[model samples]
Target: MLYGAAYYHEYQPYERLEQDIDLMKEMNLTVVRLGESTWYSWEPEDGVFKLDWMDRVIDAMHAADIKVIFGTPTYAIPPWMAKKHPEVMAQHHSGTYVPYGYRQNMNHAHPAFRYYAERVIRKLISHYASHPAIIGYQIDNETSSGQLHNPDVFQKFLWYLKDKYKTVDNLNEVWGLTYWSHRINEWDELWKPDGNSTPGYDLDWRRFQSQLVTDLLDWEAQIVREYARPDQFITQCFVGAYSRPEANVFDISKSLDIVAINPYHVTQSGLELDPQNDTDTIGPEWMTSRQDHVGVSQIFLNGDWARGAKEQNFLITELNANSIGGSSTNYPGYEGQLRQAVYTFISKGANMVAYWHWHTLHYGFETYWGGVLGHSLEKGRIGREFEQIGAELIAHSDILTDLSTQADVGFLYHEDSKYALSYMPALSQPGTGNPDPLTYERVFDNFYRMYFNVNAQTAIVHPEQEFEKYPLLVVPALYAADDALLERLVAYAKNGGHLLLTFRSGYGDEFARARWAVAPGILRDAVGASYQEYSNLMKEVLVKGEGLDLPEGAAATAWADGLELESAEALATYQHPHFGQFPAIVTKVVGKGRVTYCGTLPNMPLGEALAAWTMNKAGIDPVIEGLPTTVRVTSTTATSGERLLFFTNWSWTPQTLPAIPGGGKDLLANVSISESDTLELGAWDVKIIVQAK
Candidate 1:
């Protein structure tokens, strides 16, 4: 379940490590990370530290028995520790502290940058913790480049808000800062929370920068568990909602052992960096410039940035086989974007399938070259279609490892109302002076873009818990419910649970202010619907409706726009160019839950056919149905009982799918099956089915 790659330090070419070990023994490639920017290819000297060229690349990948993972080469901090400690550098919270460049730039609360990153991870874990081709340690690479705004992390967020509000008048009453007169007297007259970008000082400085970049990857998983072997696995790299404060900025699942993700899924049909070149970085109209999707709608910011940091079995550790380099689009290269972003992260439950940079660099790091097999693999190579999808992920190895699947839809996601709606910036777009931030960041980007192109799977319950394991309880934009999460959403819709909410959701109360009334105001009698007037209307209109299948003049508009939803059985209306009509959608049944309220922001094909009619009235199962939207199906069952299934053919041409109703076998085309099989794949294909008892 840990198929790996990443290595890259001038693409090893020792006459092509025996053709990359015969193309990783035809894709059964167990593990091989070895990347810490290859520590300038083994100490380009300065108080030098070498360990004989990483013990001859871990004795040529343990004489091709491959296992090794090791990384912590102090994430490129070896310009002799920033030319001898330039205050350990890094800075940037808008103070722009660049001591040097590229590769993360240490200073994680400096103690001489954690003593040269724990002496380059205790010299690469005591020189390969007794090699046999080492088996763990990935600590740093894509560590913290944004989350945890600096001033050396606001002087350790003023001693962690004076040891979690024990003094400074309980951090001036939980940062209400005595309303404008602002008071602190002295925890050294604290500062942090800036840009009155309102909403309770931009949601406690975005929950203090999402718990300061997940406590800097929980202090690098407590220094890689004092140097590895707690059953050696340790993970770190994460991305998905790639931090505007939170989706993931280091939650190393309570200090590692496993939870690495790096998805870069980019497929909004045809591209040229569509959504009008949405630049924030990574891909598809990038985001994270302290986010503000104006009002949300870039297909709910690209399926909530690829279901931000996936969870289930958790472990992508970098997915995206190709076509990036400062995009001009050209399109789906590295085998059609690694067969649809690794079949949308192993059909959403990935066990482990690393990618990112297996070479490709020609002219000095070409601005983040989305790798696969370039530099060598030589002779007019087009990456033999990613070595034939890595020889079909090594023939679907044991149904794609550890599998576990279950999700009827939960979507509560409130990390303090996503940190007061990701720094309000006056909800950016009116000269960005910052104001509009009431954020649910487009309801956590439409529950991670309908759990990856409607294969449907969501979990994050928290509206004061107990919703009876999801019957469908989406509180998207639950702007801080309280009253015990609106009496646990009115006892999970009177013990029936199938609610849906939207619009500045319940109008804030947990101290972000505003709740005088309006908005599900105590969920308007558990969404029997009451809100009389709400038409903040700024126009970007288009609402179309008429028995939903949509696409024949199917438009729903208002990207960063807002509010609408009147009532009296009007599923949708308002086709405004300038506030002509209103009411976006409304439904009610209340007790035994079945409310619906969405006033705006529903366009990605009518918010994926209203999230496939609220996941077909909460029966749930969109994970992939009716093929092509770029195939993907993540379902798992391992711990030995075994029942794995992960088909991801992200599309570049070549698919077929639809058959796994039962009889299985494709474990990477080792082939066999029943329920009338029908796969095909190719382009960026990847399959792993097991099923049959």
Candidate 2:
């Protein structure tokens, strides 16, 4: 496991290379990332290049035994390139080109942009290809921030559709273009996606945009592979779904060697809000706090998603080393918060954890975004804490390396479903435009959190994945799906895999058209239940049941389906005035397996109960039973075949655990512990145990 920070030598106000290297040695930082945010300095002119300064920095770091990951620096275009080729700037939906000065604002498909991008990338690779310190390359910094909505991009989309559908009639039929008088007789008749009312066209447009972004990344990775050594890897730093929704991460990740993510947790103040409360009416304090909860969960969720993307261990290219600036609320770190954060990533099978930056920039756009070292370039609270984390990581590097997580529960996540549902606003809340946007992400997290509460290990499974490895599979709000995927789910369940499906699963086909058959379309047989109508709840509905562990009168909100069971038994019924006694939850048996359908969005308590019950029925066991809600436990297998258990206290209060079943040594504390020994963890603390072989 490598420990370090992204270094920006150009951002320094003075020469501190020697001092920084000494401090890095003290902190046990074995690696440093450079050249990502230095495009303007790298190529000040169109054809002129400066490599001496960066070469010196790499040489110095190599002398100190510090490996380097060189960035291609194509994310930020230089002023000369943009000024000379104005067509490279991304044209927005409003028909205006994005202005210069911001990163990721250029049209990735623009020939001029690609030409200049290739030049800089090739130049950098040629200069640093044989450098001993250069161990890897970060292709681009956070690809697909801006979507191109210009004529050129639209033409490319038309070409993509033409290639896929082969004929204009096929394209028109698949997109249901005749609904809005949008039937395209000629390819030129298709305009930019500004006011298209056809859901199929809108969904396809979004998908095409994702493809363009993937192509851009693939192009860059191909160029880098030409010069990168066999030992050197290539990756791109990916942001979460909160930003850059146009980029299909799974597609883009296929071109890289390993997945890299920029995982930033929400502030401390943000963690205080009610997790279930919507942020629309909440005050800044509550809103930020709620986002913190989402952010923390996303770190774990995205890590799993990234791991599943390539089915390999990933890296944290950028993690919060200090508080962020701007409109975001900044909160100081509590005791053990840093330790808990670092260990959490490792527990999820991350090979390395690197902070976003080394020192806070003295003057820049992110001037207030704190770092390991503050603007004063001195050790601060976070820096000191990181030093301790660095020491521990260096001490346990061999034991932690190659460790992989083992999860018995899998949640199905489909990016196309998210995109298709995004265009169908009628499925969301009424009266509010863009109502509860990010609902898909929230629903996913809510279900995952329920499993987390009981300390069940889970993985994110894509719809295309063969998830037979997991005994229990939870498919939540898969509003759009293809027949092949539905058939696969049915076969999985028929083969003795337990399946839990929530509202909106299998409602539409891949083309975003309502299924011609009964509701839940092809999945009706697998689920043994059908629904013709579902309401977006403006008020809470009560649920009563004995099937799961849900308490009577438990609240169900946000959405509810009027369900009718065909071969399934009603597990729970709605207590609403008009919807009374209607099946809100149902279960049926298929072959040797079981399928449960949740017809409404269950509250946290009910969700937890349902998850716990389903997991038990699937014969899945938690890492440690009877643990507090404030504590989280995850287990991974070490290279030596030893079982490693990670225990973390997320709360500010200290937590204690009863004697676990395994005798092991607490690697963090360097102390042996017996099976019957009681374990105690301080606030925000973390403990790792390697079970006796």
- Among the numbered candidates, top TM-score falls to 2
Candidate 1: residue 472 Cα off by (Å) = 9.8
What is the model-wide C-alpha lDDT for candidate 2? 0.80
| Displacement of the residue 613 alpha carbon in candidate 2, Å | 0.7
In terms of lDDT, the poorest run of 10 residues in model 2 is: 274-283
Each candidate structure's TM-score, on Cα atoms with residue i matched to residue i, is: 0.37, 0.96
TM-score of 1: 0.37
Badly placed stretches (over 4 Å) of model 2 are 241-243, 269-296, 426-434
> lDDT for every model?
0.59, 0.80
lDDT of 1 by residue, 418-461 (tens): 66665542133433334555445655564456554566655554
lDDT of 2 by residue, 411-468 (tens): 9888877877676743344334346555666677777777776777888877656688
Number of clashes recorded per candidate: 29, 2
